[model samples]
Target: MDHDESPVLDALAEYHDRGYLDFAPPGHKQGLGADDAVRRVLGPEVFHSDVLATGALDDRRSSNRVLERAQELMADAVGAQQAFFSTCGSSLSVKSAMMAVAAPGETMLVGRDAHKSVIAGLTLTGIQPVWVRPRWDRELHLAHPPSPEAYDEAFAEHPEAVGALVTSPSPYGTCSDLKSIARVCHDHGKPLIVDEAWGAHLPFHDDLPTWAMDADADVCVVSVHKMGAGFEQGSVFHLQGDLIDPVRLKQSADLLSTTSPNVLLYAAMDGWRRQMVRDGRELLGSALRLAHAVRASIDELPGLRVIEKQLVAKEASHDLDRLQIMIDTLDAGISGYQAADWLREERAVNVGLSDHRRILAQLTFADTPERTDRLVSALGDLTRTSLPAPSSVVLPEPRDLELEQVMLPREAFFAAQETVPVEEAADRIAAEQVTPYPPGIPVILPGERISAGVIDYLRSGKTATMVIPDAADPSLKSIRVVADT
Candidate 1:
């Protein structure tokens, strides 16, 4: 139970110290076989660490159980009964979580503002989703995580639902009232699966919103790469309580997860867990202070407003992660997309998530005062310079945005489908999800009737350079819809 022990890292170190030869699938042979150019640019250490999880990270005999110890350490680090690491990121972890709870043809309550990955899970499982409506901010054209009252209503309507899944601390950092929502699910004798992908650091900090595990969620999936020190694609799903079977969770993950996992990712997660356990309080405290200063400074800049107060309004989110410094770019006479692009292209800085009216700057334990100063300076420059506003996306009225679902996502997506011009696509059943990336919430989900308002929003949003990566036609000149019978 010693948190100091990083079994994966220790084993990798021993492998190097013992000079073990690997005739493994990587074919890199511990960087010796790597191309000189590749090694020169990437460094020899990357290839050296590119080891096979089974034969290289652990012995072929499977006696060491290095990953097992690492997982145990991780579970212990976070307050979870069990934890499983995933190299495939939370996308696969969430899909596995969904499958573990509900099967094909079963019903589950899901947040309508869920990420594209969640929709993909519904498509793969064919689980009938009873969409739980999020608290929409009409003034901002944004969606917050659904309130507990919404879940209570959905469960009342569909008591047959096996479970519920909610996304907490949405990419913009608006959090759901998980404690109340989890209580609502438990009242219905169903488990709650929280997509807390943006809240990995919540557990380590007291000022942050409540972590799902602490809030009684049965299964909570977190992306360590997002808020923790782990490498990209590193994720961990935690489970506490008897509501969800631990064995089944592992089985589901095994079905969806890769056979050859990355040792580097495992090592990074192991190391990050140690770092957080040892000094996360001090580190995150420093980050919180810096964020406070940054937020005040950004607010002082003319024509720029940092969004903190509105996020926690009574009708808005239950909590907010202030680490996500969301700024309204509208007053600066540009769209969030334009500000984000200008920041990256002109100032060599990149913000986290950008939408029609706002740009986000994510502060982390890794951020320093110098870096924050640079961000403030670049944003100030943006405020002073006048820029033409980006093309506007047609904002749909709340009523018009609610398209009726005609079929299960799987059926409509795989059904006979054809592309039709944007104008002609109205009233046709959508055969694919059209989402604006960054936040990655789908405005048009498969199986829903595509309304003219939704179509116009997408087409105009695309014209303004919104990146709709999931659409069958990214250009949005035409859309894929279920063909007429």
Candidate 2:
């Protein structure tokens, strides 16, 4: 395993050097047919690199094994037993991992705070999910990853379960104790799958929270697009341990993955792996220090409190990612929605995910002193001109908002579903997902028995500009429900 070898990139370079052109699917003939308008904005290099994984990057038969070598290099770089690439992004990678562990109708213990993609997996695979509760910070109004004790309880009762899945470094960067959870699952001869989607850089650095494989997880999925230097839609899943077969995991990914994977993403992933292997710790080391300084500066702002290790003391989470600078704007007399809107419109500084209480400023190694200074100065200006008070958002009490599933997600979703006015949709079983965008976790999963309190929260949240993308109506005036015969 020569760590410096970038097989995908090497092949792509050779392909271009040979001048072997084909008038194939990309009518552009490598930018010849590409429109000037599109080229002016996106540039011709983008088109040049928009190659098919097989025919464009390598020969039709893939004699070079370019992708295979790249995957191995990635695995070695991260210290995982095996690494598999997915151009479909971690959304699909996670679904493939779930399918490999257990078939349809089997039970899997899942953190209730999981991203909507996990909910989508349930719909696709028909896996019964036993929910594990996250510790909710009543005062901060934040949610962290579920505790190990919670998963232990679920496994204790559902001994017949095949495996467990947990989310680490949640959108807000709170992490779970994967080591403890792994021990709990392994004691029962079950596997632990960590959806470390926001933590591609975890393996590249030492000071960050524990990387899944280091904590003995059987399967871990990472989205390189989030924290690594790769094109969007680039994802990889690392598999280890006897509980899951590498062949079966690869088969599952192949089943859902696209045949025409992007060559550019592959090359980027390959390069990132090399960069990390050679110099990740150094890069990430600087990033962690810069993030700390940024957090301290932000905390000095009036009406702002940066969430850090303090939130881990809350119920569910065991750790946190300090790079995710989460600030509670509740004291500012404004909702997170307002602050986000103001920042984007006024200062041209766009934050990441925002909810009722906070706006997250997601930092990466890409940030420099100039950009960070801009962010701090912008926040200071915004606070100085702040308005009188933010309208209080009424959140549903936890018990009232938690809905019950009446049917399998797949059944209620694809079955006879029709739209009903939101006013009348309460208490009616839901047939579609109601999710909050940015973080993209579903608030109301399919087949769930709906409640009035949940509806009120969603309705109000919608009015206040909390994004709910999958609703039948973006306005949420009506909800799709299981139709009657």
Candidate 3:
């Protein structure tokens, strides 16, 4: 495998060199029909590369195997047996992986800390989720990936479960011990699906947390756009071992994928694969160094502390990706939401994930000293500013946050539903998902009996910086619940 040759990029070049014309569905016809204003804003090259994947990118028959070759290169680069590209982002890729391993009505052991997308997959596919509890950091009010023992216990209890899925390098960058988790799954004769959406760069760097493939995960989904240089929505899922059939995985993806795939997204991911193979170590190494320096500097700032030791402690996450510099703003007498708002409004800087007490700044190979210096300065300014008092979020105890699932998610989601006032919604089965954005983990999932503690948390948090984009009523005044029988 010549890593130097990028099939998609080369094919795209050939497509231009051959001067192929399109009268296809895009209707833009290579920007000729595109409005001048749209062209000026998006650039003509965006439209130029927006060619049809089957007909224009690889000919009508796809005899060139352009996409196929690119996928091969990606799998080889990541040390996986097979790889599939997705223009729909890791959300879709993860759903495909889940469906491939477990069918409707089958059980899959899933970490409760999974992103809202995974919950959506459960609802859409009707896959029964045996929720594995994550190792909760009680002091930090955060959840790390579930421990390997948790999965083992889950499988022991539900030996009928088809497979397991866990999110490593969580949005906050705390990682699970994937090698041990994968072993637990295999010991039960079940495959492991790692939603390693934040770990695309792990393979290129040794100091980082272990890559899912290296840990012998049967299937792993990664978003190249997150940790690698690629267009948004660019994602790749890799498969290894005979536990999951490659044909079934592809078919599962096809069931949910778009008929009109984006060639630009394909080209970007193809090129990123080549770039990472050639120069990823050097680039990611530099990024690691920059992140360390930034972390130390931020920790030195008054009233601010970068979380590290606590995250990888014995009872917490097995590993931590330091590039995710999580700053605890509690000592600064300001909430994470307040600091995030100040940085964006006053300093024109945007931090990644923000919660009641912490703000995360995600660093990648793309960051430089100058860029980091700006972040440090903005953060320094944030500490000195006298901001408005943050609204109090009525956070619940870890035990109270775990709502009991009363019905299947699909059943409750599609059942006759009623909108009820938040004050009276407790004890009722939820008919919708109410999640905090950024981390995007659902506090209230469909089919789960809502609790007063969780309701208070969401209502109070909403008054602060919490943005619940998926809630039917973002205002939190009312909630959608399964109708009384």
Residue lDDT tens for model 2, 160-195: 899999999789888899999999999999999999
User: What does candidate 1's lDDT look like per residue over 136-155, in tens digits?
Assistant: 79877788788899999999
TM-score of 2: 0.97
Tell me the TM-score of each prediction against the true structure. Answer: 0.99, 0.97, 0.99
Question: In lDDT terms, how accurate is model 1?
Answer: 0.91
**Model 3, 334-453: lDDT tens per residue?**
999998889999999998989999999999999999999999999989888998778888988888799999888999999999999999999999999999998899999999999989
**Model 1, which residues run further than 4 Å from truth?**
none
Clashes of each: 0, 2, 0
Model 3 segments more than 4 A misplaced = none
Clashing pairs in 1: none
Each prediction's whole-model lDDT (CA)? 0.91, 0.88, 0.93
lDDT, model 1, position 141: 76
Total clashes, candidate 1?
0
* lDDT minimum window of 10 residues, candidate 3: 20-29
Model 1 — which ten-residue stretch has the worst lDDT?
A: 20-29
lDDT of 3 at 244: 99
Candidate 3 accuracy as TM-score: 0.99
